[model samples]
Target chain A: MNDSAIDQKPQTNSIISGAQLLIHLLEEQGVTHVAGIPGGANLPMYDALTSSSIKHVLARHEQGAGFIAQGMARVSGEAHVCFASSGPGATNLVTAVADAKMDSIPLIAITGQVSQTMIGTDAFQEIDTFGLMLPITKHNWLVRSAEELLEVIPHAFEVALSGRPGPVSIDIPKDVQNELINFRPKSIDSTDVKAPCSALDENDIREMLAIIKNAHKPILMIGGGIIYSDACDDLKVFAETLDIPAVQTFMGLGVLSNEHPLSLGMLGMHGAPFTNLVLEECDLVVGLGVRFDDRATGKVSDFCPRAKFVHVDIDRSEIDKVISSMYSIHADVGDVLRAANNSLQHVTRPLWRQRIEKLKESHPLRLDGDDDLFRPYGAIKTIASMVDDSANITTDVGQHQMWVAQAYPFTRPRQWISSGGLGTMGFGLPTAIGMALAQPDITTLCFSGDGSFMMNIQELATLAEENLNVKVIILNNNHLGLVRQQQTLFYKKNLSAVKFQQGVDFAMAAKSMGVNGMNLGQVDNPHKQLTKALREPGPWVIDIPISETEMVFPMVAPGGSNRDMIHGEEQ
Target chain B: MSNENQSLLKLIVNNHPGVLSHICGLFARRSYNLEGVMIRPIAGSSSHKSCVWLLVNEVEKLPQLIRQTEKLIDVITVEQHDMKESIFEKTEQFFI
Candidate 1:
């Protein structure tokens, strides 16, 4: 497996192929696995991979390989690598790459192009992969020469894993991989990225200190930015020190331990009623590394109207894009949180804590009335109870997505992954696939809605094809629950195309896809089914048919204040 | 939606070819700007509606606008809704 014979770099010694450098570079970057299919143009790279220590997973399709890499990233919270030959192979990886772009997963997709001589002449399998992937990736480059391959291969990995992680591509010409080069591993020096001197400048820190010291009621809204910036430890320390209630964004579900008294559950459309109520009353709102998306804000103007906003994020563009902030800081979440922790005084928002406690006591997350447990809320609670603190959970977008965010008690940061920016439909299944592929040893869960499941249900075949051990929990409500809920609240009793005429047999579908599937009902004993499915040999899907009329309650009316949640209509 | 102060129109269609383009081009060709538009799968129904709420300073042109849109082959019906005051009402419920 040693390709050291190809490592000769002396000009007179021998002309080594560039593909040899690619293989060595991947190895140097700690790549232990590559998911791809070899083709004529990529034969050299494939040969190198086969002879190297890195194991190769032959995906059924190019897109499946990309999804596998994405799954790897989701599970390991690290860069996952994939490879494909040019033309159709490169194009096929687009959807998964786009998915990665939307959800900010770090993936390295290496594409093989025709030899340099045939690149411009439209040879078979020739493709302008760099041009094709430009709009979708964080950065993309084509290896023009064998020497360039050395720089681009490792750089692609670095860029993919750095700064709010995203997909990056390196297109290598066939001839380049065949060329030889001497390889040397060196640490990347990034002086250009100057660290912020402190979480806040003296003036802003003083102002924030004054606000926290003087305020009797303050709440902290944490977002995925904390996870992205690796600020969980600092955030936990700061929250505990100040005794501030930290409410998480849907993407920030596991940022704070769910059991913490000051940890308010997710706050938004599907947020805990108590969290929204407390947000409405807080005198000060310190948002950490979270974008105030419309879903989180409900109605932008009415969001936290009574609260004075202090926003901190690495990306300044997100600070005032939705809600105006009385004070703002643009820095890394970890850096800012660390600085804040250092400067934070002996001040506790006791009144705020009391008020939040009272809100929690007043309106907990619950299904309407003494209704039987046909609700997804109880199911979500049960799942959360069963999953460990570090379980990697992905969810499909919809009412169920919000419900998972609100109900699940996450104990570790970045333990949850769901579509956030684009609210993409098919994100759950593929993302779960990626997570499972990434963390082969850990248990990964994909919670999806029947409506959302249909969006990318085809990936179940890919799941089976890859023999990935991931579990899926389908919240089958037989409707586009979120849209249905919105229409119910505003569309004057007009519910169209939102109902399912016939029941969905997910177990049948799973079996057909060559995987294990189980259907669970409220009346049926699910403990055995749950344990068996969780311990199953391969991918498992649990179909839980929740009531079709079920609605995610504690909803803040559009453009209404967070406190203005319209409870179920009076009978 | 109401009968008075109409500003919104729900145009049902057979989900046929060129329907979306025809409706959009009709609006563009007529120089009419839409306030908002929402299209979703009709519940329990096998049809799609391009529900549009138009904002205009000239109320007299509303009827002609609807008439023109209804002439499309795919459009089954055009129902104008009372959306003048409902603009803020609908917006206040979600995106605002």
Candidate 2:
């Protein structure tokens, strides 16, 4: 289509309501959909959505709405919107909002505040939403006037997406949402958001380069910050040029194409066996955008005991917050990559490359090289192949999260989103809800461990109500797989709180929520069931009943090197 | 370990409201735990930013803790200067 074919200019000079202005601003920012539940306090806003072009999904609950927005934001790399009424509705959205804030997903939560007259009077369904959401949000505002709603609505989106990216909120009084005010939409500038100072210190950069050049074994640990900064290409190039072994955190998945030789899968508690081993043995660790979370480096004192760190991050506070640094570069990963590309000479290290190859062979993630019945690897491979390169995938924390990280072949950045630092359970369902809301056109897959899936199982009702086409894969081992594996290794098979006498009937649960569900993993013809689920129109769940005895291998024991892996039960 | 003049302190205080604000404010605002402070919520806590344990040495800097604790409305109590006890009962793991 030609530029002239579309309406390029702002249409009218007519007076409009504040609700309409809010809608117009949201449309101007290319936002077409919202995940929310309407109530008396903001009935006018819902009524306005009917007149405006934006589509709104009525969530079963406010928490579900917030999480759906989170999924949307993570997938689209843009801010997502969610709304709730006063009191209980607003309070219910807290956990989801806090999830977005913790994982640094860009989300906008607009709550309908009580009437301005009800302020401090403690009327029915009245709560100070702005005050309640303070700790969980990056920036929050109380729109006192209808005129302020126009400015604040768009501004909230800007703050939520800019810089580090987090959830922001705006509380609109019920009266303001209903009032007809002369709407004037003006673009706001937020360029002054405190960003990491540009350009790494010259000495620091040079020192880091020298260390990389000198080290016999060097590994690059990438984190969520890298994806947030959109510096995947630079990270990939740096790793390739130096032939460094690279291990990513859970958030750092998809930073490098899974096919890349330098990509050594994930590291930490549930990380690949070789990844942890290499990290331990490496003489130098070039930290890029990763916040050395405790999960990745168990006992910090003994973590990478031999490695000297060249910690590079945009946040100055994170530099020495965890591991002490041999050289610290506080700048955007993109800037550092450009600087490194210009300064460094290509030097091949055959020995270093060989070591990486050995590590891969030693602790390869093989679900079943021959045991076709246990199809963890095959299932992951199939899922990875089936989804679009750009499709977004969120995972619940557990064995499934780790398996996906190790086996799923991601070819682009930001395709995989998870609760990395927090290892939060119940993250998958909400994030998937958000993804489907954000990218309604693209298919989203949320892989959840049976235990983790149960934590936020209630969100299924929200998905059904909203009619979101989100596909969920429940890896049902009927046990806390990771914990079970840990106990088997360390506690001499004393499995406690690991087994469930009767597995949850997810199919029935989905039906209760008015959604489609099936147990596909145990079916002789699972392909047909899985294909049907993928093609279904609304939110769907496929419970894959995997073997409970199955253990995700290449495990690194506490207080041991990654090389010292307890591979299988017999081993 | 005593030769290093470093003590790894673990204090389980009340998961009171504004407890984090006070503890962090005391450390960050007053530059008390400036060397480094890693505070994460202990697994089972209903309160917000509650049940946070701090890993710091210089437990002898007690008077500072008491004064800061008094200023914070959320802090239920202050338990500092427990060196030998922490070594015996290592409830938490310290990572860098």
Candidate 3:
């Protein structure tokens, strides 16, 4: 990509319609496929796609199309594209677009709008596309003319995939798509469309290094931003070199390998009792790319109460948002980690490692040693052993998501995809399909809950027909497990609308839709059964029954301190 | 204003088509409510650039919100002012 925005227009403009120009720009961006649909306003663009090499995968719903784009972005770490028509089509794509926004997925969402003349006339298939999309996109445009497309199209991709990437929308009017104009393939002013984080002040790094040298008991907190900035390698070298105990936030799971001596798994409300206890005792915390979110820090004031912080984040806003810090570095995690490592010397902390080992042994994450008929925890552990560490694991929201995070062993970044920020249910199947489609060399496993699966279960058709090598594991608990646990814990165990009294035969449903399905119930050999099903060709849905009474433990009560957690012993 | 009234955020952004929506979307995702908005092209400019003033209800996260606004790619400068000082009061007289 050029350094700045493409500013110079073509020396000589060639006549072309906006629809044709849009196609040419897509070709320029090296787009292989798009999740989209055709409608009245967007038909011209759809027609253009027919002749173009960019394959369009027709989605059953606009939301599904949006999610497909999200899934692709998550796997490829590149800007993906999705399209929908005006009015209801654009409305349908809203959830997916919003999801992309919260998770920082890079996507270009194009919607067809009514012709410019009919924009405000209350004509058929007309709505305020630009206004509706304003609050849901990273940036959006109402393309008034074909001439504007020359600048807007390239700029849209640059904005979507640049620093702190997110979804951008372009609401193209039908008239703009249909209008013919002299297409200028000239250099447009390409300004840097990203505000890069300021570099860490050298003095700040030295001071942080001093803090590291001084503290006897310190921990490294890994967050999702590290993964986004590709600082995993740098973080590993730094943490391992200094022998610091490292704990990952939900999004930071693979910054350090699960088996590493420094790795302390995930920390937060649903964190291990031992991990939380370690946080309570630490003297200093070096948080890299993590926001110290409420879920991660139970009560804001009580998190690492005595610990001084050396916070590093690309976004300056996240630096002091939750916990006040002794020092804050408003720079990209990679740059800061690289610079900090140079200033520090290798020093081992045997005493700190001993303390962590004791903590880990005292409050182990799982009690079960093997997979059984009912424990999702054991099942995850078994799956961890069966699949390679590099396999892509995508999860839906709820108990299963936590189970995978806690039980499975992740060794690298970009292998774990979940709706962390928005916690959107029904993200599993379609996301898995999209991710697997993007990278066919590896198998993708979608861990889903019954409640979450039903939210967008129609995507099962997409999974079945596409023949993507995805393994769908349904931890069927017959209830909204996490929500039920929350109500039980806080609201006097009143089981409200959380139960699914009449559960559908998920295996049968999946089988009918052209994929292999197996319902392993009350099985004595669950590991063997699961492994056999996963080995089958194409996509397969494996439904494993779980107990409704089972609840994830070590949960810190809302607004309560990290130490104020409710463990299994308390229950 | 007791830190609860609508505050005007003036942003000087590169005249990119996507700048305005990006600012709005960031606030929306955070569930931050906006009161009003106005966008105008800067005069005497060959560069395609514009100024946007958004009136959003002040909350506890005002500082964080302003910092995020500054991070948007096209946004060059961000200024915050009391709603009482907003030109909306002056402009409303002409329209209403």
Candidate 4:
């Protein structure tokens, strides 16, 4: 089968058993690898995989399998596959499915089920996998027969990778997998699908470009969608050509290089103080492939109160779902931005640059220079300076996540991976493993906090087994710092359920899991030790003691607008 | 969602098996309850499609839901009807 003629009607049944057909389809899709675990229910597919050319990675846990597939998808922009069995295997996949939905990553999750006869009889390992996945998945199907596999499997891929990309699940009963079916490849067109970059109305684009051209202070806000559409380079060119300073959401970190003169790093609650202030002063914001998430926009109404929004998103729903876009374009962001750069005339905004320069000088990411304790900012800065700009960073959710976004200078798309929207804790280690497996040539770093690191600490064994080059950097504050900070600030210093009463030695914990650990807690110079961890190869956990008192600053208090940031004077 | 705020939402979608699940699941995830649902397959269409009517609360999040619902792969078009224009109201009259 030539790659160019995938749509051609197959002359004959190029498949045998249902499981074999599934493998054939995967091969046809050019799937290099699949990450999953084998169980009693899905043994048929696993058996087929054994005889097939497709490489199967046996993950320690179903959740880990999901994230590994996520790593592959996030990096390559390809719809990757993961497998799980019924009951527990299916249940464990929920978190990752939700995470994919929140981040809009393209993933196809195939789970096994009880035999068709015992589907509702409460048989062994039987669970409503389809029902459980419905909410988290973009779409799902329970294949009743082997004959349906031919249609459902290909349709799943189309749904997962199309429009605003997300996860799609297909639950196949055990008997269905084993059932032999004779079928010819019917040229069923890939679901009434819309093209990726749809044509935009010329008048709409003209109106948007006019607003952008007239604005004195125009800012470009980029998001994960830009990366999904492979528009980072185009976005950078448009920003540079028009002299528009660009700010990004955490997911949008690498859309423009951090060193780019116009790049203002991240914006929102945990965003840079200077960037937030710049947004406040700007007259217009050109949002490309970005949703105005509350985390990025502070209080929805008060966020950039003076600026008129010109939003460009592939999904029509995101256009005015949050902030009302005075001017909006419905098309792929890369296409729109490329056209905008070509069609619109360039204008210099010298006054806007001066204001931004002053803002950056006055309110840089704050760190007390004299404090010698292992603050997150200092440690992150040291790692950033030590590692090459090409290194990929994954993180778990907490204060550490915010600090990583604030401190690390990421310069490429898909280089920054974290559980952004879902904010799933314990995402760092396993996700890092998946990322390393996807691209072994580049060093992958996992930035985690003590609290978040403990969520999926079981994956340390998996890391050791694979011996992948993933450096686990943990900020051991001996407390849930983010929760404690909120308690102290908003709850009148009433801290509860935030302390790690019996301190678990992370180094010893990692060693017990058969992985080497290095403690930078008591060290005078941590950067040199970290340098060794980066180059030492394989998985090494570097645990550094940080202060629970050091809160991630420039925080917009809960229910507060971005403008109402709890900053220097208030602190 | 408020008790007095009933919104009659209508959508035209391809008659795909999982399309209903996608729309309903979206609302379920947001914890928004649907008051009622009615779907009727369009007859004699070149591409088999259906018209669906959902009764929900007209809240601030309704617009977002509408947008999301309209974005589903199977959905062709979506329209909103106030109390007077509601098909649910007409159906209620039919039952009465």
Candidate 5:
């Protein structure tokens, strides 16, 4: 272990309760904020919080707390913390924890369990939190005793933030939290917690370079790993030097600015028609820090059919798990790119670039009614235009999320934060609240649809309490638009239980929650109203009513090849 | 007891309450076919480690399975062995 420790010296040979010790250790780990709710089991930890410097944001629900912490972690690129009580609190946190696991965000979820004696005895609020969290988290622990907290807490941080960062849970029984221990203050060093990546084999790097050099048409497929590894600059340089057109996975968006000449934007599923077309004809696919997710690679057998894949990721399991690669390097992508840059020569592929330009001209992403703010694409574009590159964008999963992904001009890494792998609805408001909390200076835009906004609508109360600058723009369509779209396309228009029977007055709902609310439909000058709403500070819900019939076009039907795209009627 | 279709995997893991669950959960969730499992604390070892042997019939996915298993934090090492050298072969009489 590196001798460096958290920047605090502990008091020697002091007596402290397990709860107090946990709080102190968290302080040492530099956790400034924790999002959670107090319940019967975790009251001791909550009591300990009163005497600590850390600020607690009491969320309306445990799921909100979990995503709130995720928002902070995703923005800061650090292991952040959340807390919940046993049973329902832990269960409620399941989706957010699983979301972190899928997205590889560094988060530490600490749940309070029932007393040690009551474990497995059918005690009230007693469920097997460790077992519940085991499969979803990277690692989980059930603290056996008060003394074990010292080891478990720091180790949880290490496991969560180290190689291939992910969420981890530590379940502390109420009795253990109340147990008194003779604490010997040992310096817990988490500064060097990140595991040193294994040394890259020179032969593998040489082989990857050779494949890229020899291929007639090479494309760079980047993903979330690039952002996690902080390799955006290195990736940009590598792609530019090789003159390779880069296509981002949903998680990989913002690694290259949408305006970059070589940028092909997002690929697969709801990707642009031309972007997916480019992938079909490419001879070499050099995937850096990507898993070739099913959404990004529609039909795995047909994706990049003409390309020889070269996958470089930190995790060995991701290799050959989805798509087999001709050259696979199980090392950090940033390190690999840095090494490749040393020997890389500036090369140009005029013929391949010309071919890509031709495809782009013929089959581009259709943004119908983008000039009208009432349309989905138009709403997203207008939001993007209002904020500078410093603004952070988040979304709840649905038609609105896809619209933002398709239309938003994401220019920097960590700028676009959404639920990618899990595709969880109701992810926007709380996560954007987190973004606002982490970076209070910049505006955080959450583009949510009516169906997704209602899932975590209760979190508006939490947002009201924080009073942060998070503007939630609900593209009100009164239905699960994506589900309805699929029903129309693939299910023979057999719409089942997708449309909402009752209409919700979202503006009134926000106002009832003690936050600012606005309805574009009621305003005569929507442009003026929107500009004023976005420019002002504090939380606001801007409800823009859009037609329910609109669909996200250039979509590849589920299980279909990316090449066989289903385009909507021309604008 | 040994067969051409069976493969033996030896895992050295931290001996703890939920470590076994973590290992077993991975197998179940990934849909990997696990034929049998045996686990015991490493005798006379001070480090509190255990030895686990998994008998599986997934020859094609063994490499990927091993890679996934190695990713678990509690697992110390994974070694592949042939069914001919399996501990299940030696302990067959107990089950019979």
Candidate 6:
């Protein structure tokens, strides 16, 4: 059937199977694409999808599908859906869903369960998906009947998108999918179903302003919430108007342009010496849309010990989860920032700014060998120079990821995408595919280490088939660099199990998967080859080799205060 | 059974298959101590709603835990009451 023929078919007040109804409901929610692979359980939903307009991208694994959905949702700032079968398929999606939950990305995972009657009978492809997803999701549902899809589908989107946006899951039994029912299709507007934000307290804004007025050395600590709530513009204005420097958490990297004078790069564990030092001296810490994660707040008690912290987040539970706040505002961070911006005075502590400038000059982030393209920092900077600010950058969890975070000059919100809270190694490739799928006009760069790349290397086939404008640059070090670094620094140099004895040739592997591959190691002029590969790209994997001895520096020992950072040269 | 160290929490929540699990799961995952729990449908009220009364310790984390519980989709309202007002106190004789 063609598009017009499907459009002509009667959609409302007609008898349809539960699976068909689910497709129609998803269509109503404005979902355009879904990523998943059909299996024994979820085949019915896939079968129904053939008649609908939704395009399904078949992922090599359920984990890839979940991360693909995450990529779309993380970039678009809306809830995107992924599907999976029961048992192993559902289990495979756990990591991605948990990653989404940790990062507060809005995602929906729908899984097919065994027939309702055979739930506890140990039937084929059976698992308690509802129970598995309960702890990870914002909310979840196990559909008992076809009729419940009407309420569950919309509520799933609502729960996933509302408040502190996070992943949600739905488990549909096979019997429910096959169950026939008369569905009166109502035009459910996606906007209408969104829950309204609670009214912000005026007094909270008043108190925030009063605190800002008294503090001599104040710093604005921002996070992903600023990007999610679309408060980046407000934050910029507020920080500039007050002449206060702002420090970003890992997830909040692109909220302020890296070149912004008030922008003090990322703070906490892997933060620059100046950024962490400035945070240490601050008399007041205004945390906006930040959860104060341990990675960003090493030794919670000792972090900003002199600062009176004020936290603003949409979720109240996060206010005192790690560090107690002097004042907590439970509302959208955008709402709080907008309110504070209105009443906040134009004040500047020139003395404090001078102090911060002095620290920046004295203890700067050392970028050794940054002029050489083969080096980590140099490779990242060269890549950033190749792509415009519009391009999206993603990285797998390792030293390569930290290198990208440190060197990539991000200018706009939502430009930097990575697994911050969960630090999943295989997140880079699939997420870049999703980003490319959502916004095909711009380039999507996936910077992965050899260890991290091998984890989801199978997704290269999906990338080749989709023909997305994604460039995968594997910084092949032939070892788990971060783990090796730790072993070298802390564990008496007994480097065991961190190195791959025999490395797989990534360039040849990419070619076998039908993607264009280039190995910089084999080329005489790697810079020229890299330039050519990045310029002409549908899907290309460029293997760039770096030494394993390179480590992400300015590190804080686990459980140590951020102020006492272990420098690279010290090791 | 009423003691200074304990507090009673009264929660009005949606009576559903997963609502109880959602509440109990929060307690278990967050490591909040739950001494006792009593739940039943409200008399002469809508069948879809139920009242759950819980006896819990750790008064310092009570306020934070209450906020977390309220964030659950099924939980409607959570109210803190003194141990003297505990519903479990009156029914202690039956269990004993």
- Among these predictions, the greatest lDDT belongs to 5
lDDT of 6 by residue, A378-438 (tens): 8998878877788899999999998888889999998999999999999999999999999
TM-score order, best first, reads 5, 6, 4, 3, 2, 1
DockQ score of the complex predicted as candidate 6: 0.55
Candidate 1, after superposition: displacement of residue A82 in Å?
Answer: 2.6
Model no. 4, DockQ: 0.57
Considering the two chains of model 2, state its CAPRI-style docking category. incorrect
Off by over 4 Å in 5: A1-10, A187-197
DockQ of every predicted complex? 0.01, 0.04, 0.47, 0.57, 0.71, 0.55
Q: How do the residues A396-509 of candidate 1 rate in per-residue lDDT, one tens digit apiece? A: 889888777766777887677877876777678877877776677777888899998886677788788778778999989889888898888889769988887886789889
How do the residues A1-571 of candidate 4 rate in per-residue lDDT, one tens digit apiece? 2112122223375546677777777777788889898898988888778766676777778998888888878877889999999999999988988999999988899999989999889999888898898888877888988888877887888889887899999999888888777757656586456564457677876888788888888999989889988888888778877899999998899888888899998999988889999999999999988888889987788888889999999888888988898888888887787776677556677889999999999988676422342777778887777788878999999998988888788878889998999999878887887788789888898999999998888888878887888888998888988999999889999999999898878889999998889789665666677788788778889998877888888898876888777864432
**Model 2, range A404-521, lDDT digits (tens) per residue?**
8777778788788887655778888877877777677777889998899987788888778667778888888989888998898889999999998888999889898888888885
- Score candidate 5 by lDDT: 0.91
Judging by TM-score, tell me the better candidate of 2 and 4: 4
Q: Which stretches of candidate 4 lie over 4 Å from their true place?
A: A1-15, A195-198, A369-373, A522-527, A568-571, B1-10, B14-19, B30-35, B44-48, B55-63, B79-96
Report the candidate with higher lDDT, 1 versus 4: 4
- Cα lDDT tens digits for candidate 5, A150-230: 878888888888789999999999999888788786666664243435788888788899988899999999999999999
Cα displacement (angstroms), candidate 2, residue A403, comes to: 2.2
Ten residues in sequence with the least summed lDDT for candidate 5 chain A: A1-10
Candidate achieving higher TM-score, 2 or 3 = 3
Give the Cα error of residue A489 in candidate 1, in Å: 3.8
Taking all chains together, each candidate's TM-score versus the true structure is: 0.75, 0.78, 0.90, 0.92, 0.97, 0.97
Q: Which residue pairs of candidate 6 clash? A: none
